[model samples]
Target: MTAKRIENGLMGLAAFLLLALMAVTGIDVIGRYLFNAPLSGAFELTELLLGALVFVALPLVSRAGAHVEVDLLVSVVPRAVSRVMGRMAAIVSAVVLAFFAWRLAVLGITQVTDGARSVSMGVPLAPFAFLGALTCLVAALFGLMREMRP
Candidate 1:
């Protein structure tokens, strides 16, 4: 599939996760305050969902060049120099993100082997960790693509 299509899919998934997180939090709040009872796993679920949402959104955000940047020097620099600086920044970002992805993958594997789970809910954390790693890899690839563009 094309990079754009992949980004679109990722973005959609992120959006869905965001909405789910909102609904889950809202329900938990109402249940706790109004009914004096809360969902058992709501906090753990929200934490996992938030992580997934951010990671899944990264690729699309990078692809769309929507990442926050301080452009104060861009106006003073020559156009060509500005472009080169932007590409260099992208390359650096890609390398950093790739490193993070690798670390996250390793951590995920370790967590799985150690049978790590959420404190309250006992939900498996390895899968979400691995998913975060995958999304980071995708985001790094997209950043590389952006840096390589003519």
Candidate 2:
């Protein structure tokens, strides 16, 4: 399958997770205020879902060239110079993201070895960490693709 398709799938998952998070939070808030009882582990689940949403969407956003940027230099620079600078920026972004992914992989392994879990729900964290690392790596690849593009 193509990278664009994979990125789109990840973006869809992120969107679904975000909607789920909203629902969970709404239920928790309403239940707590109106019913005197809140959903168990709602906060922990929200935290995990938020992380998943960001990481999963990263690659799609990178691929679409939708990331926030300061384009002040682009307005003043010649077209060729601007294009060169943009490519350079993409390369730098890819390198930074790759390093971040590496660190996340190390952290995930450590979490697994240490038996880390969410405090409220005891949800295993290593899986999510590893997922984040994978997404970050994908995002880095997308950045490199953008850099290589004409």
Candidate 3:
């Protein structure tokens, strides 16, 4: 899919996940206080939702060009130099972020293989890891492309 479409989809998914988190959390709290029992997997669900928030936000932030950048130096630099500097920054960012993606993937796979799961919820943690790693990889690719821009 195109970057724009991917970004839009991610943003929408993030919003939906956040909304779901809030609703679930509220229900869980009410159930605990009003009744005697809380949702069985509420905590685990929240943990997974936290990962979802970060994973989904990355691409949207990239597409919006909302990530922090120091434009002051670039503004004063010559146009050609500024362009080169921007590309260099982008390349560095992509490289570093790609490493993060690698790490997350490794961690996720290890957990999955080990059969790691949430204590209360019994949900496998692999999905969160895999989703987060995939999104980071996508963002790294986008950054690499941005860096390659003329």
Candidate 4:
């Protein structure tokens, strides 16, 4: 319900996804080398999990303003100017991320209409696409929240 609670939930989800990715990769490697049989659709699973993990963690990073930045120009600017620059940067980031979310949602709808599936596993692609869109939208909101702070 609360922002911290939501952030914690996202962190837990990201951690779980990361662990699942590691387990999947390890099992796939062991199966391939020792048993002479790789896990079916391991690559697709990894790709999806990695993508999910990145997006899942994005909102937290945005909320914390923890994104990597080169502040060389900010150091040279007046405090007022630097503050304005930071706000402008946040606005730009939010806009770009929102655009991505919209585009991804559109792509997800298209995939659904086309009955798209993964190459090997035949896994439906629309859900993951929609998940990506949702996370990007949340990240964009967090970016705006960062701009609002102080």
Candidate 5:
């Protein structure tokens, strides 16, 4: 899929996840305050949900040019050099993303092998790790395309 499409999907996923988090958190708070009973897994649930939300939204933010860029040299350089530097940065970012994805994949595999599950929800952690890694791969592909484009 195109970078823009991926960005849109990521944004949508993040938004949905954010809404879910809000609902869960709100429910947890209400239960504790009103019922005098708290959710046993509230902390773990929030941590995992927020973590997923952060990772899901990261690439979309990066694609939207929301990430910080330090262009001290690129800003001062000639046009030709600036463009070359931009391409180089894109290439490097892609490489970094690739490495991240690979590592995440390995970690996910281990999680699955170990049969690891979240403390609160009891859902397998591997799926989320894999999804996060998939997003990293998508972002890397986007970066490569950005570099290859005119």
Candidate 6:
């Protein structure tokens, strides 16, 4: 699939996740305060959704070059040097993210092997780890592409 198609799909998923998170939180709060009964496993659901949402958005953020940056050195250096520094930073970020993806993949495998799950909800943790790993890999690719851009 095209990059734009992938990005649009991710964006749609992120939007759905955000809406779900909001709905869950709102329902839980209303239920707790008004009915004295919070939704069961609301916290666990929120935790999982939040984790997924962040990873889902990571590639979008990377593609948009929206990551936070400290420009202290870049601000002082000459334009050419600053450009080089930016490229170097992107390369470094790609490397670090790739390493993170590898570690997450390993963790996912271990979780699957161990039959790991969330405490309250017994939700499988492997899928979340794999999602995180996949997103990090995509974000790392975006970082590498950032270095390629003029």
Question: How do the candidates rank by lDDT, highest first?
Answer: 6, 4, 2, 1, 3, 5
Top candidate by lDDT: 6
Badly placed stretches (over 4 Å) of model 6 are: none
What Cα-based lDDT does every candidate model obtain? 0.89, 0.91, 0.83, 0.91, 0.82, 0.92
How much RMSD separates candidate 6 from the native structure?
Answer: 1.2
The alpha-carbon lDDT assigned to residue 92 of candidate 6 equals 90
Cα deviation at 97, candidate 1, in Å, is: 0.5
Question: RMSD in angstroms, candidate 3?
Answer: 2.0
The whole-model C-alpha lDDT of candidate 5 against the native structure comes to 0.82
* TM-score of each predicted structure versus truth: 0.93, 0.94, 0.86, 0.94, 0.90, 0.94
The alpha-carbon lDDT assigned to residue 79 of candidate 1 equals 96
Candidate 1 vs 4: which has more lDDT: 4
Q: Which stretches of candidate 4 lie over 4 Å from their true place?
A: none
TM-score of 6: 0.94
lDDT of 2 at 104: 92
For all candidates, the clash counts are: 0, 0, 0, 0, 0, 0
By summed lDDT, which 10 consecutive residues of candidate 5 come out lowest?
58-67
Model 2: residues >4 Å from true position, as ranges?
Answer: none
| Model 2 poorest ten-residue lDDT run | 3-12
lDDT of 4: 0.91
